[model samples]
Each structure stands twice: as C-alpha cells, then as structure tokens.
Target: MHWLRGMWAAARSGVRLQPHHLCAPRLVLRATAGLALAGFAGYWLFGLAAGVLAMFGGFMTGITTFQRSWRPDPVVPLVCALTMGATTFVGYLTSGSLPLFLTAAAVWTFLGGLCWSLGANSGPIALNNIVILLITVTLPNSFDHALGQAAFLTAGSLIQVVLVMFPPNERWQWHRTVLASALTAEADYARGLKDNNTVHFTPDSFLQAREADTLSPWQAAHQPAGLRGVRGPAEEIRPILASLADPAATGPDTDLSRRQARELLDTAATVLDAVAHAVRQGARVALPPDTAAALAHPQAATVPADPAPRAATHLRTLLHDLIEAANSPRPGRESTDPVRPPIPEQLRQAVRTLRGELRHDSPVLRHSLRSTVVVVAGYLIGHNLPLGHGYWVAMVAVLIMRPDFAQTYGRVASRFTGNLIGVTLASLTLALAHPNELVTGLLIIGCGGLVFLFMETGYAAVQAAGSTYCILGLGLAGESWSDAMPARFALTLLGGLLAMAAYALYPAWETSLLRERLAEWIEANLHYAAAVIHQYAEPAERTALRTRDAVVAARTARLAWEQALVRAADEPVRHRGLPPATAAAAGQAIKEAARITMLLEGNLPQSGTAPVPASSPLATALRQSAREAAESVRNNRAPTWEPVRQALADWNTPNPQEKALHHAGTLLSNALDDITTALDATALDTTAPDMQGTR
Candidate 1:
C-alpha cells in the first residue's frame, strides 16, 4: 500500500507544469531551423530514411548544446557529436545478432550510467550516445551503409557545433552572468540581515563564479583586466558581511550602534546590487547619488564604532574595487601564459575520480548495475513481444530513469503521460488529415521547436512535444501511422513501469544516508573552526593554505547535506532514522558554528605578526573533539564538547591584546554546546519506537 501511495504522489508531483526561465530564442530557432533544413534536404535529394537519420543526429547534438554544463559551450557540441556518431556506427555493426547486440547494449548502458560520475555534462552526452545507438540498431545495415549514416550524422551535428561556436557576439557572457549572480546573492544576504541577523546564506554562486574564472589559455591571454582579479575582493566581502551582521559579535539591536550597523548594511546592499546589475548588463555602474558619495568618501561618524566602522569602510573600498572592475576596459595586449591544466592531466584526473566511484557503496556503481539489468531486460521483452519497435521500450526506460528516487519516479510518471498524449494526438492527426510529405515535414519541425522552447518548463511538456516529433518523423519515413502509434504507446508504458520497478528493487533512498551526511557536515565544520583557530595560534603560509582547504571542504560537505535533504523531502518514506526536527536543529547549530568560525577567520592576524600561542591548546582540543563528535553522530549517540569547554576555561585570562581570540573561543565553546544539545535530542528521537525501523 505504501509503495502504491508513493507512486501516486510521485506521479502527481512529476506532472506539474511549473513556470521556468525560457531558453534563448535564437539558440532554439537556430537548432530547429538547421534540423528542419537538413531533414527536408535529405528527403528531397535521397529518401525518407536518410532524412530521419539526419534529423536524429541534429536533434541529439542540439540537445547536448542546450544542456547547462560548466564545460566550454563549443566543446560540448563537438565532443557529443563525435561520440554519438561513433556509437551509431558500433550499434549497426553489432545488430546482425541479437546476442551480440544485447551484450554490447548492456556494456554501453552500464558505461552510460557510470558517466554520471564524471559530471552533469558528461552524463547527458553519454545518454545521447545510448539513444542514438538504440535508434541505429533498429535499422541494421551493411558496413558501407553504416559508414554513410555515420558521416551524415556527424555532418548534422557539426552544423550545430558551427552554430554554437559563432553564437551571439557576447564574449565572456557566462563569466559575467555567474559573477553578477554571486554579487546579487551577496546583496540579498546583506538586505536579509537587516531584519534577521542569522539569515541563511550560501556561497554556491561565488563557488560557481570562482570556477568560471578559471580561463583557457586563449581566454587568459586576451581576457579583460577586470575579470581576472575581481573575485578575490568579492569573496572577501562575504566573511565581512557575516561578521558585521552577527549579533553575538556586535551586540543586540537595542542601541544606536546596532541601528547604525543596519543602516550601513543597507547601504552596502544597495551598492552591491548596483555593481551586480552593471556587471550583468555589461554597462557602467549607475549608483545613486548618495550611495556614490558615501563610497567616494565614507564618513567616520556615519558608521558605528567598534570595528563596525572599519568594516563599513572596508566594505566601501571593496564595493569601489568591484565597480571599477565592472567598468574597466579590456586588455590591449595578450599574455602567453596558460591558465588551465593540460588535456592529459585533465583526463588523468577524470579517470581517478571515476576509479574512486568503483566501490560497492558508490551511487554511480549501483545505478550502473541497475541500468544494465533493466535495459537488457527491457530489450529482451520488447524483442520477444509480437509487437515491433522493440527499441522504444528500452529507450523509454533510459530517458526516464535517474540516480535518485525523486527524479526517477517523477520522470516515469511524466514521460508515460506525455507519450500517451503525444502518440494519441499524432495518430489522430494522421488519420484525420492524411497530410502529404510537405505538411508532415512542417509538423515535425514545429514539434521540434516546441521541445526546445519547453526544455526547462517541465519534462512533461518536453516529452509531449518530443513524442509527437518522434511519431511524425517516423511516419514521414516508411512506417504506417496505425502500426507506430499502438507500438509506441504500449512500449512507452512498459518502459516507464520497468524503470519504476527497477528503482523499487534497488532504491538509493537519501533517507538512509542522512545520518552519514549530517556527520560529514559536522566533521567538516569542526575542522574548519579548528583551522581558523590554528591561524591564530600559529600563523604561517602553509597554515593559510590549510585554512582555505578546510573551508572549501566544509562548504562542499554542507552543500552535499543540503542536497540530500532536498532529495529526501518528497520521498514518501516514514521512520527516517534521523527525524526531521533533529536534522533541522543539528543543521542550524552547525551553521551557527560555521558562521562564528568565519567571524574568527575575518579577524585573523596579519602574516609575520606575533601569534597567540595561548590558542594552541584550544585548537588541539577542537581537533580531538571533532573526531569524537563524528563517531558519536554515526552511532546515534550524543557528542560531548567537555574538552573544548575546558580549553576555553584554561584560556580564561588571556592577554588583553588577544581579546579577539579569547572572545571567538568563547563563542566556539557555546556553539559546540548547542551541537551537543541538538545531538542529545537526536539520540532521544532515534531511540523512540516510532523511529526504530526504516521504511
């Protein structure tokens, strides 16, 4: 009964048609027109099969281009085109024998599923390869014919590559957009802190912008001066914003100081927003007159005293630098330095990352196994069925299944309904009108356009258009509309069912992993906090690097936990070992600890300055307590921070000059106490009868 309910709920959620940002019209129109042209020309010159093959090649390549990947835009189209072309040729070669084809298909399907381990971009490309291969095998041919089809497919894809390579005249558009997003996020955070000091802020945009800043050799040599070093100041501003808004460090808002701080924070928000807008639009900064005056010359009296004023001044300076960077002219000359790792090194790193996922516990490995089984099973059943078009069953399964329950189930529901609507409508149209080749060709192009237009709107809409396009394209070929319609409808239904069943049998429920995710986040935060304290204890070049690495790891772990929480939310599983209330409390406590740690990091002493040796004991205690807390979390026991408290007690009367370190230590101890309290509640919750068993 629970499983049935889960399917119903997932189906409901999946079919929702939410509003989403539209893709660029130019990009959509270009790909659609190119596909239409190729299909029509092929049909006019040669035959319907050749036209359909050409359209398939173009559609596959264009879809890859439409995906949101961190890889260079041009690179994706070219790589995917070549990869799909090769897969098509291979599929044709193996199609002579069912056994050979199934074995090869199983291997290909597993590798395609494993491609997710590489990255989001690689996953889609691999899926496209699988799709082309499946479609290719349905039409077995001789070697020469296979080569001709491969060439036609490559030519179709290369056309899209050309279109992408010479897109609209907006060099560095992606970098500018990401950087602008980061600044806008910071601006929103600043404004949010006015009402609530502890508003949640994520550095995801900043991380993306940082990654975008890593330029290729040609980009580095000719990039604008503004883009090169602006992110440093932008990142520096985040910690300062966190520090200024922290009531623990700055005191309550019941006084003049707090009011002044809020006013300055609002001013900073205004400036940051303006800078972000200018950066995104690629225009000169247009600050308000008063904000401009303030940035030009910050007044001492206008800002609060007690580091707030200095922090406000620093904010002003950073804002000024950002504005300048936004408006700075491009470099007149190019450098000869390489900015990215070599191709061989990158391939080696990719291989190492994939190797790390070979473990039994790895989600990629499990997904690959499931994918291999389901695809091969679907193939065997589809082939044995009296109804033809066997590949449709496996294709439907491949299109719907994903790494997580939420996506897999949601897509299964959406894709099935969509295929039903599409097949019925296209079949009705064909039966009613009996359009000629020209009208059919135009209908195919129109459906293709709809697919691109609704790419992000929702899967249901895309699938609806895609299914219609598939029916029309195949109908334009030699297939009878009546025959294609029922086969497609039944096979699609079978594939979605198979996908759902496979996932149920081998589920990777995020609920089961929440405890480990929470533990990882807690451990990372502790390490980050200890690293900040160590900077106070013994400042050095290597110590700074260590601190940076620790913070990065902490952010990564935090992001992973947040993602898992979201994925697990809609999963209809009761009795999650870690209760929601306990998870929320633990998350809040860890975030507070991380914020306090960032505050300490913001006030780190300058290099070559005298170190606060008194903090050495506290740092060591933090490291020891971190390991203990992680183990306790895994065991569903309360974590103790007695050692941290003791270390703080021992440093109770530190030197006056080390007051910052002393105060930060006190806050850390309190945060650790909160974590302990949260974990105690967790211990109590997990032991309850209601939470004793997993779904």
Candidate 2:
C-alpha cells in the first residue's frame, strides 16, 4: 500500500511540467543542421533505411553534446561516437543468436550503469551508447549492410562533433557565465542582509564556479585573469557577510552598530555587483565612487570595537582582491584547445572513483546492480512477448530509470505521459497525410528541431518531441501507423511499471538516512564552533587554518543534510526515528549555532594578542560534547549541554579586556541548550525500523 501511494505521488509530481525559460536556440539549430544534413545525404546516397539510421545517429550524438560540463563540447560527442560505432557493429554481429546478444547486452548495461562512478557527464554518454546498442541489435543484417549502417551512423555523429568543435571563439565562455552568476548571487545576498531580509544563500553556483576552474592546458596557459583566482575570495565573502549582519553580533536594528553594519553591507553589495558585471561583460571593473571611498577608509564605518568585529576591514581587503582579479588584462585569444589534464590523468581519476564505489555499501554499486538486472529482465520479457517491436520495452526502461528513487519514478511518469501524447499525434498525422519518403524526412527533421528547442523545458516536453521524431523516422523506413503506435504505447506503460516495481523491491531510499545526515551535521557544527572558541583561548596561524577547515566541513555537512531532506521528501519510506517537526527544529537549532560561531570567528584576536584562559575549559567542553552529542543524535536521545554551561559558570570573573569572550561563551552555552531542548521536546517514535540505507 505504501508502495502504491509512493508511485502515485511520484507520478503526480512528474507530470506537472514546471516550465522555465532556459532554451538554447543556437545549439538547437546547430544540432538540427547536423541531423538534417546527414539524414538527407544518407537518403540520397544509400536509401531510406540508411537515412533513418543516420538521423538517429546524428540526434543521439547531439544529445551527448548538450550535457553541460567544463570539458570541450566536442570531447564528449567524439568519445560517444566512437563507443556507439563499436557497440553498434558488435550488437549487429551478435543479433542472430538471442542468448549471445542478451548476454552481451547485459554486460554492456551493467558497465554503462557503473559509468556514473566516473562522473555525471559519463553516465549520459554511456546511456546514449547503450540506447544505440539496444536499437541496433534488434535489426540483424548481413555483414556488408551492417558495416555500411555503422559507417553512416558514425559519420553522422562525426558531423555533429565537427559542428560542436567549431563553436564561436569565445574562450572560457562557460566559466565566465558560472563565475559571474556566483558573484551575482553573493551581491543579492549582501543586499538582502542590508535590508534585513532572510536570504537563502545556496552554494550551487559557487560549486559550479569551482568546476569551471578546471582548464585545458591551452586555457591554463592563456586563462583570463578574471577566471584565474577570483572564486576563493567570493566564496569567503558569504560567511563573513552572514556574520557581519547578524543581530546577535551587531546589536538590534535601533543601535548605531546595526546602522553601520547595514552601510558596509550596502557597500559590499556594490563592490560585488561591479565585479560580477566586469566578469560577465569581459570588461575592466569600475567601482562606484561611494564604494571606492568605503574601501579606502573601512575603519570609519567598522563595527563596535568589542564583542562585534570590525568586519569592514577584512571585507574591504577581499573586495580589493576581487576587483584586481576581475580587472586583470585579458590574454590574447588562441584557437587551440588541448585536452584537460591530458587523457592519462582523467583515466587515473576514473579508476580511483570506480575503486571507491566497488564496496557493498556504495549507492553506485547498488544502482548498477539494479539497472543491470532490470534492463536484462525487460529485454527478455519484451523479446518473448507476441509484440513485434519488443525492443521498445527495454528502450523505454533505459530512457526512464535513474539511480535515485525520485528521478527514476519521476522519469517513469514523465516518459509514459510524453509518449502517449507523441505517439497519438504522430499516428494521427501518418493516418491523415500518408506522406511519402521526402515529406516524412522533412517531418522527422522538424521533430528533431522541436526536441532540442524544448530540451531544457522539461523531460516530458523532450520525450514528447523525441517520441514524435522516432515515429516519423520509422515511417520513413516503411512502418505503418497501426504497426508502431499501439504497440509502442502498451510497451511504454509496461516498461514504466516494470521500472517502478524493480525499484520498490530493491529500493535505495534517502529517507532512511535523515537521522544519519542530522548526526553528521551536528557533529560538524560543534567541531567548527569549538575551533572558533579555541582561537580566543590561544590564537595562532595553525588554529586559524584549522578553524577555516572546520567551517568548510560544517558547511559541507549542512549542504549534505539539506540535499538529503529534498531527496527524502517524496520518497515512499518514512524515518521512524526522527519525525518531520523534530528534524526541522533540530536542523534550525544547529544552523543558529553555526551562525553564532561564525560571528565569533569573524572577530578573532590576532596572534600574540592576550589569550583568554577562561575560554579554554569552554572550548574543551565543546570538543568533548561534539563526540558525545553525535552519538546521542544517532541513538535518538537528547544531547546534554551541562558541560558547556558548567565551564562558563566555574570560570573566574573576566577582566574588562576579556568580557567579550565571556559574553560569547554565555551565547554559546545558550545555543547548545536550544539544541538540547529541541531534541528533548520531541519523542523518538522508533515504532518501526528504518526503510533502507544509502551512503
């Protein structure tokens, strides 16, 4: 019953096409041109059969080119073309024997699934090759015919790859866009802070920006100054801004410190916007007059002397670096693009990743196992059925199923609904027009264009366009509407149901790991807070670096927990250990604690400054509590903060110089108590066991 409800929920969420304006018209036209040229040329040279195969070859290769990555656009398509050519030829050779072909295909599918261990980009490329293999194997041909077909298909893919390689000569275009977006997001966050609004600062753009830093050898030699080292300071600004505007650190809205903080934040926003605009436009940075003046004399508007930081001093320094980096002169543009890190480095990294995923607990391993078994089972069932085009069943499954439950189920619903609309429309068109080869070829090209145009709109839209395109291409090969449409529709449903059922039987639900995620986050936050508190006890370069590393780990853990919550939201299974309200409350509490720690971190004393000995016990207590609280969280028990409170109470009265540290200690003690209370107020149900586990 839970499984049925889960499927229903996934289907309902999937069919709702939340449209966005993110289309790539230029790329679509280029891809479509590749498809049209090969399709028409093949028809002219060989025959209608060659034209259909060539069209599919060109289109699937175009799909590979659409995957966004830091790699040169031609690299993925070229590799995929080679892989597809080899697999297609092999599949054709083995098609005469069912057992031999099925065995070969199962091996291919398993390896393809494991390709995810290499990277996100590798998975799609492998999937495209697998799809081609599945379709090609069903069509047994003589050696000559098979060789010619593979040649034509490879030729079509090469055509697309050539087109991609010759893109407009704007070096580091993708890198510039992502870096600019990260700066723009930071600018917005700063403005929101100035306005005292709750801003949701996500690391997604920054993460993408970091990925953009992976440059090819040619790019590395001639990388623009703006692209070289701007992201580090930009990333550091997020936490500092969060700390600067925190009311706990800067006092209430009516205070002079709060007003000063707002002014500095506004100036920070202006500086960030200037840097972002320069990166986006490939021009020199031009800071506003007021922003320049603010940076010139940051101390005039610094925060209150004690307890609060003079964050503007550090903020101005970072802003200067950002401007300098963005304004650095551009290198002369070169057309040469060497492979990034060469091929050897990429292969070594892939090997390392695959080795790591070979363990039993790895999600990639589990998913690969599931995909291999389901795809092979789908193939066997579809082939033995009375339906003529049995490959459609396996093809549908390949197109829909994904590693994660949400994506797999979402795609199942989207693909089935999309195929329904597409098959019906194409069937109706064939029944009415009864078009000839030339007209069918034109229609096929048109459908291909539609697919790419709406590619980013949603999966449902892409599938709708893609299904229509496939049906028209089949028409070019002499398949009638009656033979193609009804069978395809039935098989699409069967494939989706099969995928859903397979997932249900061997599910990898993220919901089961909610408690684990929370525990990791709690431990990380406490460790980071302790690091910051220790800096007050004994400030040093080592402690400063350690604090930096600890904060980064805490941020990563927080992001992991947030992602887990999203993945678990629509999953069928429930976390019996942690209720929804309890999880939210506890997460919020930890977030607040992190924020308080960041506030202290921004105002740390310089090395050789007077050490606050009283903070030592509090720091030690925090370090000890981190280990214990983490264990308590995992066991579904309320964590105690008595050690932190006891350390604060037993300490001697602070001198005037150490009052700020003492006050910060009191704040820390209160924050820890809030976490304890959040857990203690909510009872752990533990009425049922966890559904599943994932790493």
Candidate 3:
C-alpha cells in the first residue's frame, strides 16, 4: 500500500493541477452517483431492466459532453433514449432467447456505430452513450436485464449534464493576472529598446512570456462558465496594445493609461534586451538612468487591483533573474551573443501563436471513425485468415490510437503491457474463487476509483487493465475457467494487433497544419501591431486604449506562437514548412520586436513628456513601412525591403528619435519579410500539386 501510494504521487507530480483540471473528475463522480440513484429509483418504478438501461444511458452522456459552455440538447438525449427503448422492445419480441438477444445487440451496435460515425467527432456525450448502450445490449443476457441496465445508464448521464450546466468557481482570475503581468513586462521591454537603437531582443524573455500566455487560455477554458469571463475584456484591450508604436495614439487620460501599461510591459522587455546586450558584451551592461527609473516605477493602475501586487512582485523577481543570468560568466556564454540563432523569430512567433486556436472537440468521434475504417479494412482482408475474431481485434485497434501523439503511444503501450499483467492477475484470482455479482460489482468500483485517481496520469492502461479483469470475471458468470480463459487472451491480443495496424497506417499528422495556422495568427498579430502604430498618430483615441488592453493583444500573439511550437514539436517532420533560413529570419524578427517593446517602455518618461512633430520623417516612414509590410503579409505578396533599408540608413544617422523609429521600422520590415515568405511558400506548396496534375 505504501509503495502504491508513492507510485501514485510520483505519477501525479508531472500534471499541473489547476482549477479546470478538477472539472472532469467532479463530473465523473456526480454522473456515477446519478446512475446509481437512477438505478435504485427506476427499479422500483419500472422494474430492474428498464432502470439499469436508463442509468447507463445517463452516465455515458455526462462523460462525453460536459464542457464549461455545455447546454443540454434535448433532441439527442431523447433520441438516444428512444433508440435504447426500441432495442429493448425488439429483444422482448424475441421472447428472451439468448441467441435472439445477442443478434439484437449486434445489429444495434452496428447501427449505433453508423449513426455515431456521421458526426461523432462533433456530437456530445449522449452519442457516446448510444455507442456504449449498443454494446451492452448485445451481451448475451435476459431481455429484461439488458433493458434495465440501459435505462439506469441513461438516467445517470442526464443528471450529470444538469449538474455541469451550473458553473464552477472562478479560478481563472490568477491566470488572467499572470497574463496581464506578462504583457506589462513586454511593454516595458519594448519601451527600453526605443531608448537604445543598438539593443537586441532576448529569446528567453519571449519564451517565458509565451509560456505564460500558452497556459492561460486552457486554464480559462477550464474555469466555470460564470466566473472570470475575461475573453471579452482581453478582446477589448487588444486594439490598444496594437497601437503602441504609433505616435499619434498618445494623449489624454485614456491615452495615459495605455502609455502607462505599455511602459510597464516595456520595462520587462528592457530587462531582456539588457540581458542580450550583456551577453553580447561579455559583461553586465549598466542600465541607462532613464531606463532604470522606468523599471523602478510603481505598478500600473491599469492592471486589475487584485492582481497588481502579485504582478509587481513577479516582475521584480523576473527582472532580477535576468540581470543575474546576464552577469554570470560561464562556458559557451560567448554563444549567447545576438548574432541570429538558426531558427527565425518570426517563424518561432508564428508557431507560438496557435495556442488559442487548436481546440479538440471530438476525441471519441475521431477515434471511432479512424478505428472503424481501419478495422473494416482489416476485417475484409483478414477475416478468412487463421486469426479468429479478427474483426474484434480490429475494433480494439481503433480504441488505442489517439490525436495526442505522445498520449496515444503511451496509452497503447501501457494498455498492452497492463493487460498482459492484469490477465495473469485475474486468472489467478478466479482460480481461488467463483465469480458472482457482488464480487464483480466490488472489482468494478475499485478499478473505477483507481482509474479516477490516475486518469490524467496514464489512464488508458489502467482502464485497459481493469477492463481485462472485469471481462474475465464476467466470462466466469456460471462458467468454468479453463474453457473461457484461453479464448479471452486470444481475443485481447487480436484486438491489440488490429489497433496497432490502424495506428501505423492511418496516422493523422497535425504538425504542418499547426504551422500554417500559426502563420495566419502572426499575420493577425501584425495587423494589430500596425493598427497600434497608426493609433499613435491619433492621440485622442489612444486614451481609450488601456494598458490592460494592449497587454491582452501581445499576450494573445505570444500564446498562439507557443501552441504552434508544441504542435510542431509533436510532429516536427510533418510541419517543417519554413525553410531554415526563413525560420531564422522569423525568429530574429520576433526578437527585434521584443527588444523594441522593451526600449519603448523604458523610454516612455523621456519620450512621452514631449510630443513629436506630426510631420517627423522617421515617424512617417516607420508608420508607412509597418503598414505596408502588414498589408503585404496579408495579401500574400513579397514584402518590399526598400523602406526597411531607408529606416536602417536613418537609424545610423544622427537624430535620436529618428534612430528609434528607424530601428522599429527595420524590425517590422524583417518580420513582414519572414511572414511573406512563409505565406508564399504555403501557397506555392498547396497549389503546386494541383498545377502538376493539370500539366
């Protein structure tokens, strides 16, 4: 027992248990209770068979579709109920014969599979219940007994859905606070870059901010629907953040708030830029007096008051860490100098940009379709072979493959290994005792509880092992062990092989798609960035854009990039769309942007007090170049580099503000170039095959 507890703790250590992680387990427990209760109530009201079926149906539904936004779709649940009822009616018509009941079960399972396959990928838990009920009905049993099980299941599933409809506690507040702080850090970083034209961006700072952003949305989704609903708030703030680079967008009370928030984010950015500079110089770079002052400023009032203290504390700590790391002398420290890393910042940013977009809504439907197709194909070819119950093996194959590549492999291997162990254990247990209902029930509950505890920790294998024991126990229901044990082992192996074949042949690759999606996100962020630049010219409107708002936009872009990276890493070969050169360029572009944000934040006090001339050549050129590059990326055209060259030329010239503008313009141009190349590459690849066929 002690060893098991130790093992369980070790397994759970890797999983970050946020507020949303609790939602699934709570739903599972409530649904289980509901099913049990429904069985008791319905048994007295409508007899045992009907009660059981209702409970099972309800239980299945609850597990499948309990999301934060879950609203009951009465049509599907009622239809599922009717389907189960009809199956029961047919079994009754057959007069309780074992063979007849089996036939009805098989037919219903096929029908259920077909119905589910149509939109199973998108449908709710009720559909899954239908699938489970179909299988349960087919088990060789009395007609009344099967019907009762289905009824109980259905009632339980319904109860779960109702309970889930009520929202959980607002736990997303901390996540939002973290995101808002990260954004402020970025703004501060950007401001600092504006103060020093020679500064380079640090990848580590961007990586940290990106990580925070990546986790934020998933955490938000897990929160109860009612509490901390800040998607709206974040969206509202996006435009303000985007307009930070524009000079016209700085004036008035509202504009001051945006400026303050941008300044705060820029402070963090400045720290990163300083680190990069220190790395380049091989010594600690002393912060400019103005930059140090900005970093020392009190927390921005624009951020939520509740989160402000934590945010300030975190920012201070992060800045201190960056300084310490920058100052540290170590081997290979020379390589930290900002001469472009192999991967481009733009591509990295694009990849990181997809966290918000990739939502997996239909794990089961995808599993079912992929499984069915693979199994059916295998059965058609292997049915006449030496393999007995080959079709059943193929069905098992479908269950093993999943979309999460790491998880799928882990589950398949675990399940196969655990089954081998479990089967041995179960056989030994049965040798000592005769299987009955009470023993079966106890095993089910014990296994189910273990599964609940370890579900997130590698549930597939645990469940598989449990199922192996349960099935073997069922096979012993009034039967001798010798006859059934051998057949059960053979069937299990057959199922595993079919699953393996399907997994190998029909693998779904998400890597390339993730890259493409991330590229689109980069374009969107660029659009927002361009808008921010334009807004700077309209100072009156800048006040309307809060610092919180700008932070949200930057955070959104960072989140997308993080998600894209995860997906790409999952299947790197499949999604390797950006050429090495292009990827490097993109990465550099993001680094430059981060540095620019830092400089801008750090220099706000110096630059903000005096309004630049409207006709300033540097400002006009920066605005024009950024806008054009943004448009070029959107239009899928090659970005013009001439504006960037001109900006760089000015950056090297004498004017201070002009130099700042020039540096920003150059960075924007580089980002645009990377985006344009990626988009063009995508378009060419997508069309090339079609063009070749035409030829």
Candidate that beats the other on TM-score, 2 or 3, i.e. the better one: 2
RMSD of each: 3.0, 4.2, 14.4
Each prediction's whole-model lDDT (CA): 0.79, 0.78, 0.44
Which lDDT tens digits does candidate 3 get at residues 65-176?
A: 3322211233344444455445444545553554453354444433333333333333333234334532453443665555555445545546644554444422233333
Residue pairs of candidate 2 with colliding backbone atoms:
none
Sliding window of 10 residues with minimal summed lDDT for model 1: 330-339
Query: Which has the better TM-score: candidate 1, or candidate 2?
Result: 1
Flag clash pairs in model 1: none
* Candidate 2 whole-model C-alpha lDDT, 0 to 1: 0.78
Tell me the TM-score of each prediction against the true structure: 0.94, 0.88, 0.54
Which ranges in model 2 have alpha carbons more than 4 Å from their true place? 1-5, 44-46, 140-147, 169-171, 195-200, 247-254, 286-289, 296-309, 330-346, 358-363, 530-549, 604-628, 640-666, 681-684, 693-695
TM-score of 2: 0.88
Q: Which model scores highest in lDDT? A: 1
Clashes of 3: 101
